[model samples]
Target chain A: MPAAPVIAIVGATGAVGVELLGSLARRNFPLSQLRLLASKRSAGREMRFRGGTLIVEELTENSFDGVDIALFSAGATISRRFAPIAAAAGARVVDNSSAFRMDPAVPLVVPEVNADTMQGDEAIIANPNCVAAIAGVALAPLHRAFPIRRLQMATYQAASGAGAEAMQELRDGTAAELRGEAFEPKVMPHPYAFNIFSHNADIDPQTGYNGEESKVIAELRRIFDLPQLPVGVTCIRVPILRAHGMAISIEFDQVVDPQVARDLLSDAPGLRLVDDWAGNHFPMPSEATGQEDVLVGRIRTDLGDPSGRTLTLFVVGDQLLKGAAQNAVQIAESLLPAH
Target chain B: MPAAPVIAIVGATGAVGVELLGSLARRNFPLSQLRLLASKRSAGREMRFRGGTLIVEELTENSFDGVDIALFSAGATISRRFAPIAAAAGARVVDNSSAFRMDPAVPLVVPEVNADTMQGDEAIIANPNCVAAIAGVALAPLHRAFPIRRLQMATYQAASGAGAEAMQELRDGTAAELRGEAFEPKVMPHPYAFNIFSHNADIDPQTGYNGEESKVIAELRRIFDLPQLPVGVTCIRVPILRAHGMAISIEFDQVVDPQVARDLLSDAPGLRLVDDWAGNHFPMPSEATGQEDVLVGRIRTDLGDPSGRTLTLFVVGDQLLKGAAQNAVQIAESLLPAH
Candidate 1:
């Protein structure tokens, strides 16, 4: 790989894409050249980069001709069609889509959890689901301390998980509600203004689990290398603009003290311990937005189990950053040589 | 008690107070007179009930002199000061505050779960917390079937739980956020617009459980008549306006089937089964608002436990109705002779 790689950002106009630009610039990614690529609709859009404006070009098979690293944040269909082509064209692809996450060949990675999974030779690296990535970052240290026997998660996800259009829908629908006007949801399936609903992803009839929940469950299992780890998840979309929050109850094989767990999380990379019991302040999505670390708090022993083998906690992280763009960028950084 | 009781509504200008008026009217509650009462500031305010406007009176020792039944939706301090005075004046009080819920003498009643606990002799009947009330209505039938071993709950509570001012704060804060203006939070400690936070209730320093969580746990135990029942609760305040949603994982003594639980809940009173697993539609605050019945859905086995004794479900209910006002009204209705 070149000392300074030529980087291409797919879905350059989407929410995660915008965050990718910011994260790359803030982290000072060593990129000799940066190409912004999107659909035909956003082709000529100019996005601010390191110190100047970069014109977005329409994504095509030839978009990765000279690119050494391609970061993809488009939907599954776009990534499915273009990621392989970009990889075949000699660019290392780090995808934020769910297309190749469960594939055995593609390493689904959370840099803080299992960065070593991605060797320099892999053509493509898959980023875990936003919820799974956040949970992985917060739970990895605890899982290492006490093997997680089971996990129960309920997610309060934001509009951005559905993409930039859904974020716009949340804003516009909320504005319309404030104005006392009727809002017919255009991007999201439900009226998202000051409302909460089950994730819009298709539900598996037999299991009654939505696609997003399934992705989080499977991705976390894969990331933790616990193939048989049992996980139950409920994914809900709240009216939040960008960040995601999750309430998690974990059962471990052995007793785990809350203070020890807090200490482990405090020292864990990519995690910020926000457990302030006296202040009644815990992880909140509003404070976690645009922040890199996953904020974790409300760490206490599960009240239902007197055996002291279970704990409950809450976590919040910016979906656009740690969940999507920052995770993919970290994977790309792992592929590069020492700075 | 009088044949046609004079009903007084304390805190008649609040959110739950408004719902109490609507519920009483919709249910065609028998009353010789309806008295609206609020603080001194709102004494002259008018509220429409049963076809005419009733002038709000300042709640005092004399407000309940001729009243036979009083519904209190005021805060705990107001309930603490006025509830006993009302009872002393020959009015039976059904309080919607947390003041007397844990009092051994005050029967904490969810009509569908434990109406018999209040034998029409108790001077004051206590309404369960909003989250606990919703859960009680949905879980009572299932607990009867399999005998619940433990319960784990995560609540997506609405702003109305904090009262009318908090609801207003949510709306104005959201509007300010949409307008790109600064919002100074008055009712809530956090910026409630597009944000989810741990329930603003005071946290127990030793346990890390907030007051809302503690109430739900304690109230559920009392309502279920299981003094030693194990319940783990996490209460979160979401951006929703009126209704509350809960994700519950239940462990039973015996293995239970999803169909059996569905059948039990479908036939249960004060519950509407909305389990449309194939449609990816479940209970949501938007649909549950103003609805009397708790919407229960997403019934499935807990994937984490292979013992087949655990099930997971979701429930949504209007906090002002099923969670508060309607429950108080139902208790008052039970006090009447069979008609």
Candidate 2:
């Protein structure tokens, strides 16, 4: 039997970190040994994976010894500090943070969209934002079906995307509000129960786009190499738990049909068409929160734009699944051809 | 004083109908006698007004007799069926339904924005969609500053826009899901909690826009008298209760400054400038839900579309108040300049 691959997971105690562990077990990623790393506070925590329990160790300069693949989800600060160290120790890093994404040398990737770009990595590959990763999969096939000109999108993001504490904040805040008790918001920037917050970040006094939204737009533009494409976006965080939804309107260079776009998406690997509007069936967070495939539905002619080429759709996906862990694993799956 | 005006309320038990009553009371509309009219199911309900109880009676041919002003909050079907009857009975009808909004002869009125043309003598005055009402408040000031040539808006509508039962649907459906109960959705076309749905109504074969969204765009154009202006819109229903928020991008003939726009809106009536991002104080649904004025905020220059005169903003308002009831009552307040 062949020796299993060595896998190391940084930020193992975080939200995306937990999802990474599950995706490993679900995909059954060949593993000779699993190493868990986290901040000093969370380093000693014990977690269950499949049948065995794993103890997390504090991530440090020398933590990547004998590691073949490192998954970084500790956040941009931790990733910025530790990712280069891991890559220098000869481990290929699948970084699920924004730290290295815009670096000219770093390849921002969604495996299904750009597996080829990950091949010549300087050992550290970037995972795009959750919304971008899911959108890329759906857009890749359609961009191939019809050359595009511009895109406009609005997102309904989930609480989980903010982190574990934010999710707890939503549940606790809502429960407390129900009980008529004071709910002091700790993790989230604002009340997280029944409200939506705009994400175009406070205009940077320089760049207009919020940090999060700018990353998605810039990464999509870079990933698709469409430097001049017009992308208009408004990102909103909602009171949902896991899945994020985007209302997308596309204006392609050539005219496109709803059926044709639907067929292209149906044939795409990373997407599932849940669009039977007549039956009140379409992409929904409740259904897509744990699913690997991005749900794209409500496809129709863009009434706002003329020329049959414009389309409007509702796209939804689990922020943890396709948005984070699953995409990282799929990238690792690309490097090692053997299942 | 001369004989006070006799007033009637149609669909007295509905969400907007209730607000209409409260707004009338709060604003102190002088009424010598009041008649509450509703369907047979809600006809016998009793509503208190100004320390007095008014019994809701069945809306029939004689319901509007001797009444000088009738406020209609029923659905479009009822409004379509009875608005003319009330007008023929010598009553000025303020119909809060889509049935008369697009009617060429019927004037669409937003007193603060279009009080000049609110001749109101068609005997039937129409109300725009809730989202449109809020959007109008934000856009009117900007249009005056720049003469808007085109508009692109995406709305985050609340459940209250669907009516009292839909608000109940969100509350009940959400509670049901929490209790692990099977949710039986009835009020909305789809489930109303923890989910978002599209507002593009079933499209007419001849026109591409949905019934609801089309009404908004058409009504906006008619009220603004920008008949040739291009208005592209996509409306989404979110899991909020009473306020509706819209993300709008406009192209103006002249340059738009976020600061100057704020100054103009600061002076504009029935509008509150809530765009202070430094304080993290943009208008949100929770803040706007119960407020009379539509809160306009998140003001910024459009980063894309090199034309540079474009501005983007988020506007939120209480669908029940400014969007429906208070708006109709405000028109009535306009008729009562002495108040």
Candidate 3:
């Protein structure tokens, strides 16, 4: 094998960061040495790796001193603070936050869709939102067949995308409800055990877009470079812990056949077509949680518009894997020229 | 009020049936005499209504004797075999299953939306599918505003819609997962606790439509009498036990406005506006489980479809209440030519 890449994982103790490590090990990414970085609160902890244990270190500007590649899964604030430092330190950085996504200089990429556009000398590649990342994995093939004119999407997001605390909150809240025990809400603002919450969190009140919804729209447009592309989206937080599902309605410039969409997605990169309505086996969260590929199903030509130019389907993917971490690693592996 | 219309509740032992009795009492639907009927398996059971014990008798040809109005929340098969018997016995039957929803002679009623359509001459009234029924509460006002040309809907249904056993399976399956006990699937064909199953029951293997999706499409057309009105729907069974949520996208012939749609629904009977993203106060299953009105939110113009003729929104309602029993009872309350 070729010499391994020296990779550093920021926020290694967080949900997506942990998955980033697992995905690398599972795919056997050629890694020379793994540097795990977290906040002071989680520094000095030990976590599992390929076949050994790695010690977590506190993250600081100087921490990127010798790293070859830095993957950031921390929150936007942390990424905003450290990503530039890591990039300035001569490391290629793949950011899994909205921080640098809309920046004209930083390339937002899903390798299979925009790999070539990612390899610019600026060295910071932004990851799209999990919903867009997963949707793009399936839609890219169709867009190849018939360039999309407009897209309508409603997402059912998992809690893990928020952070480890959100994941714990869902697991513990649900566990508490089952035991008929009182569970104080700390991870999320509301009770989230069996209930599905609106994904529009912290409304801007002025623009009528919440933090989550705004991120989805902005990141999606930036990633696809369809600034004028008509898009309508409503983000919902469902009770699932790790996978996100989306009901996507697409309107293409030309007529669409359900079989054609299914055929394209059947072997699309990073996508699994599980659309056998005969077996009741369309993609679902419970089945897609630990999976790496985005699952697409309920494939059909939507006659709702009788003009019949739309194809509506459902998509499920592990929010932490393909949505965030794995995509980041995959991008680093393919390092687009625009990054 | 003139003496409460003599009322009867059939299949009063099921989940919807139980909710029907409570709703009738809570809504103070006029009731001079109450008769309860159930299958032989549940015969002689007792239920409390209006501070008195009501005996459930075995449903027979004479079950509706002396009944002025009969509300049926039984399964479709039971309704198909018995609703006509009750109507023949001089009682007006309002059925909450799919049995008569598409029958040309029966008026599928959502009193708040299409009360004027009920002439009471059919003797047997049908309640639309829970999601379809609740959707009308929103669509009727919008249809009046722009006239619906097409509908694209994705349903997140609760287990309670299947029956009491399905509800138990969800609770039991979840509890088992919590207790570290391996659970055997019985009531549900698959795992139910944290999982969202397909809205379909038993795929036909030939025609891909599930029983639930087919009913939603057929019932909507019959209720709207626009047999050609384009409808594309996907029914998903979620872990929610009693409420159903739909992410609906609609196309209209006239220009559509999101704020205008919100205002129309705010005062529309059987519909509640829950669009406050600032408060994170949108429609939800746990909140809508016992509520009568369908909760609507995330109201937005379909920016992706720039012709300004499309709008999208999210709606939730109690499958057992507004979607089923309560709708049936409301129909019986207003269907009689003379109350």
Could you arrange the candidates by DockQ from highest to lowest? 1, 3, 2
Task: Kindly report which residue pairs in candidate 1 clash with one another.
Answer: none
Worst 10 residues of 2 chain A by lDDT: A200-209
Interface RMSD computed for candidate 1 is what?
A: 1.1
- Interface RMSD (Å), each candidate? 1.1, 2.7, 2.2
What DockQ does candidate 1 score?
0.81
For candidate 3, write residues B104-176 as lDDT tens digits. 7778888877777776477888888887788888788888777888888888888888899998888888888
lDDT of 1 by residue, B206-286 (tens): 888998899998999999988888888889999988999999999999899899999999999999998876676789888
Deviation from native of the Cα of residue A110 in model 3, angstroms = 0.8
- Can you write out model 2's per-residue Cα lDDT over A67-110, one digit (the tens) per residue? 98999998889899888898898888999998998887888888
DockQ class, candidate 1: high
Total clashing pairs for each candidate:
0, 3, 11
| CA-only RMSD, every prediction | 1.4, 2.3, 2.4
Q: Write the per-residue lDDT of candidate 1 for residues A6-43, one digit (tens) a residue.
A: 99999989888999999999888898999999999999
Worst 10 residues of 3 chain A by lDDT: A330-339
Off by over 4 Å in 3: A204-207, A336-339, B1-3, B202-207, B336-339
> For model 3, how does the per-residue alpha-carbon lDDT over A125-168 read when each residue is reduced to its tens digit?
88888888998898899988898888877777888878878977
